[model samples]
Target: MTVDRGVDVRDDSGFTLMELLVAMMLIGGVLLGLAAVQTSALVTTAQTRQRTLGTAVTNQVMEELRALPWNTLNKGLHASFASAAGGDPNVDGARLRPPVEPMIDEVLVTSTTQATDKAPLSGSGGTNVTATSNPEAPGIVFTSRSYVTRPAAGGESLALTVITTWRANQTADERHVLMRSTAYAPSGGCGDPNNQPYLGACQALFSASAGGTAPQTTITAAFGGETTDPEVDATTPILPGTDITVATMRGGQTGVGVTAQQSTAVESSALHAAGSLTAAGAPSASASTGGEAVENQASNDVGSEGAAPTDPSPVTSNGVAGSLAIDGGDLRMVITPGSGSQAKVSASTVTKCTAALPAGVPCAASDLASAVASTTTLSVGATNLQLVRVASSSITGWGARFAGVAGVAATGCSTVSGPGCVAAGASRSVGAVQLGSASWSGGAASSGLIQVTSYSDSTRVERGLSQRTAAPVTARSGSLRYWNGSAYTTVSITGSTSVTASTGTVTWTGGGYTVRATGQVAVTPVTDLASAPDPAGCTGEGCSISTETGTVSLSVHYRVEGPSGVSAFVTTTTLGAARAAAGFKAAPGA
Candidate 1:
């Protein structure tokens, strides 16, 4: 062997077929294993990133809620959460990019002041642990506490729980997450009558008549006494009274009564027998006797024996006519016939009307004064009276509804049949009218507080906004709908959109469009990593790729508060996985 058999150097250059096969198989197996491992790692990493995002979103919502005012938090006007990443938007169901817009996955919100019976706990914090023994969950949750008391006091506990879920890779073994929020307030938050905070009087009155009618009334009669009808004749210079009756009565004072005097006859025959008698059988009456004669004669007979008269009795008259004759006060009368009798009488009905004029030239006290004091030159026009600078206060109690011309003034008199200072050819409506004046010649109609005037008039100047009718976009209800310049126009979805109306208010919906998720982040993965061989192979450490991803599902629940505002809540989590080492041990003998 010492024979220079130089290191038996055979062709160590190439591998044998069997060896090659073995190598290929081993490498293939290794590659397959690495791929599997890398795929899992990447998936896990993605899950974790998603979970973190979900958690951040949830926390953001909670923080927002926390910063709200106590009342607002308790009320929780608009608080919600949503996933930032959206699902595939391609209608064909193709895998798209990380969704540019977040797919509304889940949503949580608090719109009503009070929560439903199934609401979660009442607090700013929430638990995620599902195990009963866990004390609280680690997932998003909300809690609330409140106190309630009857007239006699008491209280109870309240909590809320909301959960969301979504499909990951379209697997049946779906993932799901939960979140909850709570609020605490007085138990009787609902203003139901039974649960009302306090009770009100709610009283009613009752009487023998009308069966408890709303309004009540009473009737009274007045008696005419001796004050107006006295014994004095038309020419008799008489004293005020005989001091026979008392005008008024005090608590203990007695009322007065009248007594008639007994008549004494001075017979002419007696006078003749006495020696002082005229030939015509007249009695020689002394001054005192003359006065006595007047007293003996009946001046007025209030009550006497005679045939029944056809005149109506005042007592029956008042009773049957439904009239209450009052004395020493202003009396209110209705022109209509009273309850029983058919009698015609012009009567005044008393009503507590407001100071404003109810109708016509019969001006209210305030308007009357305005008409008199207004700076208008009184000029009787040919046909119509023109009121110039006079202001109209007939509508609002605050002040005048219109301003008169500057140079000219109100020139109407009380003789005008219409309003004391009204314009001619003006249309009238409830609470207001349409008129034309030298100042308001713009074909304007006045409202309670607003004035609709034309912009055509160049000569007549006025200090008011001008209005005119415009054509309608479409017509309905027989009449051609018109826009009063300030009304209806074309509306655009995302453009200069506006709603106008001549008579009604304008409303818009879905003003601010946004998408949110309603499901919970059941599982979340934070990180994942994988390694592969590189060139210069002596089984060296390989290059590695790290990634993060997560999945979350949402419940189908959402709400819109107003045209431009909406809210939602979504569940989220974090997940991660990474290889600590990756390599290939050298084959025993290369």
Candidate 2:
């Protein structure tokens, strides 16, 4: 029964081709949207990167222009622009070039046109625009214009404009970025090669006014509406015609002529009287002119090399009458009041030093004091350090010499800690007196020699004295008599001695002898009257005696005779006579 059920089996279900196509289309559409988003993100990132590079390039160019010679700038010439190209291996996007190159972006310079009144439509109409070619690089255009401004306080100004433009990728969209900048240069003269070409013929205009003639013009162009005379009015904004012809007269005059207005009621002759016909056919002067010429004359008058006017006080910025102070020639020092009424120095404060003092050194004490007292930064001049005292607890080399002086001393001073005095330190030399007591350590001699005088007694001798510690010592012996309150004591010796002291001379013989003193009276059995005191005991006559048979210790009693007198006695007996010579005496009762 199961085998017979498969008899009518056939395929009935299947996917339609249109449905598959629709699914694929949906997938493709989603992929396309993602691609568009990726492309936009990439474009935005590239633009941001390009903008950063552009800023860097701008800075680099500005620095280069600042360093370029004025004459090079004056020539209205520059290096050629170079462009670079590259591509990614994967996407093959647009190529990128170094932005520093002038051609990194296309630049166009357009000089604004000068309008005039000759043809009412001439100046009012866009005209007088000029373009020149770069002589060095023919392919490049020198679109920047050179225009001269009217006289300024110091001099005239010449302006130049630099313009740059960049284009986006062609396939993506039509878009552009443009930047323009104008700069004015200043200098004393244009002839200096390093400073020349700051501005072209504009610089010469100042010299021309000062009696110098203008050079002949090489380039010239004439506009159809340009007339010899042009009308000037409050409403005229620019000169007539896009291009105006300019001529240079041989006699140093520059005249401009424009075609007179044909249907205008205002006559062309009135243009000259109205001060409207300028060389460029533009307005001759600014409208807000208020005593400016008078002010310039006053400045010139004040700068003139002569005594200023006694009266007619000059008006200052605050509308106050300004007065000038007269300076007394070289002898007087000028004083200026600083912040908070502190004493300060001004340009006029210098005084000429003429004569020198005989003895004392003259220092600018006031100047030094002022510098240290200033609330602002203390600017130290040579005079500011004139009276600075250097001091230290210790020093080396020449500073030590100054430290040994009698009165003067070095003070320790530093940039940070200010200054300090070392009063305890001695000095080698003072104002007039030289110190005689300075000595060196380790037995070395001081910078100065030792000084001595016999006016002091011999007892006042001094030995080694240390300069560092200022103390007397005995290591090196030398005679010195320093000031004492009382009379000097003599340190002298009478005997053989290395160092002298007050005493008798020390006598020594080749062979030693024993000295002895006998009794004043000898013991005699019932001694006769003939017995007497031994003269040997006459110690009062300056003698000493020893008693031992071999080597004996001698007892020397130095009987110093009193200031009054001295006496001695002896016996007449023979034995007594022998003993009397030995310097001993008998007992008192005997």
Candidate 3:
């Protein structure tokens, strides 16, 4: 028995220690493989669930936007719904609520692939932990952000973009899921219920009067009458010089008409009275009562009473004999009597008569001779007739003449610096002259300056004559000529001058005379409408919104758990989606 017992004692009973260890190792490997497979399956299932949840959340947000009114689509997120409600579906009233956060699960269950055993995972995964359950473990998170955009091309429809984003898992390296969707809200229903095939209500256009009353008026179509079909061509012909009449649609519509008229013609003329003549032909009547009787005549007259003398020959009256004749369109009186003891012929002896007495006044021979012999200068302000040495006993009478100072030569000084000449630095007054209505040629008299450039010194007061007997002078182009105490010269302008048909006053400056005239300006009436129709739906006459058309957009992103770590998904809708959601099938390219 001792022979085989030695071998059967160990090898025959069971495996050795090394064999047991090898079997144990094989079993451990199989169990480890099963664990790995189980973990992979769990990851796949979680990721799938996450994707479905993300899609559902995104769609939910888009559906919510589709439910809103087209007008309020751009009201923005977080807008209060309580304020926006109860209004016409076509109108953008305050009754619509803005996009609000939807009630849904924003987080996914924790994934088993998290690095740390802690509930929600720490470090990189900590920030996404939204759930309190198992906060120390890895978990998927979902976040949503929404916004709206208006297209550069404006339209009635709005695009709502909903964006949903989430982490695939609680790991730092996990991918994120993003989802986006859009819907549109558009103006629906007829804007005007009373109008058939309604495009919109007929807007009443009217202009108001000052008294707030509407006047019946005719109005022509600017382009043409309104048309329902856009493809159809419509035109309204407006006849030349014809106005269109507007039919009465409602009460209180009024119109107004205006007219404007302006006239600017200036005419000037002069009247003559007995007076003393200055070197420049300006006359100054004296206050004396002793002088030959003279008759007042109309301006530019060559005879008595502005009529041509019937007798062209000489005629005598009283001791003073004279005759009237025309010379170069001028009237002249001639005395045939010779200068002798009978009468005195001298400028100093000449006297201005206060009254008109066709009969001549008698003068003693001795008195006349004494007046002629003395070389006395005439009074500056005295109104005396210029006496020519035609006869000693009798004298010829000459009428006063008026000449336009504008564009005439000065009589006396040839240059601007001399005695009896206008001073170059002194201001002087010009005699008043009457201007006719035909002087100006434009609207209200334009304020300007009148320049005179000539000078002379002669006492011959001739009617319709501008030149004097003294030296002739002219003013410089830019120099203003004025009369000083003894002479005329250029002076600097110091003040404004006023000119009118009746009177004119001026200040001298630069070698020329400038006269400013003022005329009445015409004013026109303006017509406008008190109120206008609103683009957006109107409660009365005002608009509820500043703009009637706009756009809206929404965005969404989604995240979910995946096999590796985390997975991300994203989607975005186009403008076409907005049109489709708005039920606008007729829109182009929708």
Q: Give the alpha carbon lDDT tens digit for every residue of 417-491 in model 1.
A: 111111100010011111111221122111211112210000000111110011101100101122232432221
For candidate 2, the TM-score is 0.22
Most TM-score-accurate candidate: 2
Q: Write the per-residue lDDT of candidate 3 for residues 13-36, one digit (tens) a residue.
A: 878899999999999999999999
- TM-scores for all candidates: the values are 0.18, 0.22, 0.21
Candidate 1 Cα lDDT to native: 0.20
Q: Lowest summed-lDDT stretch of 10 residues in model 1?
A: 206-215
* Overall lDDT per candidate, in order of appearance: 0.20, 0.20, 0.22
Give the lDDT ranking, best first: 3, 1, 2
Q: What's the candidate order when arranged by decreasing TM-score?
A: 2, 3, 1
Candidate 2, residue 306: the lDDT equals 57
The candidate with the higher TM-score, 2 or 3, is 2
Q: For candidate 1, give the lDDT of residue 324.
A: 17
lDDT, candidate 1, residue 584?
Answer: 21
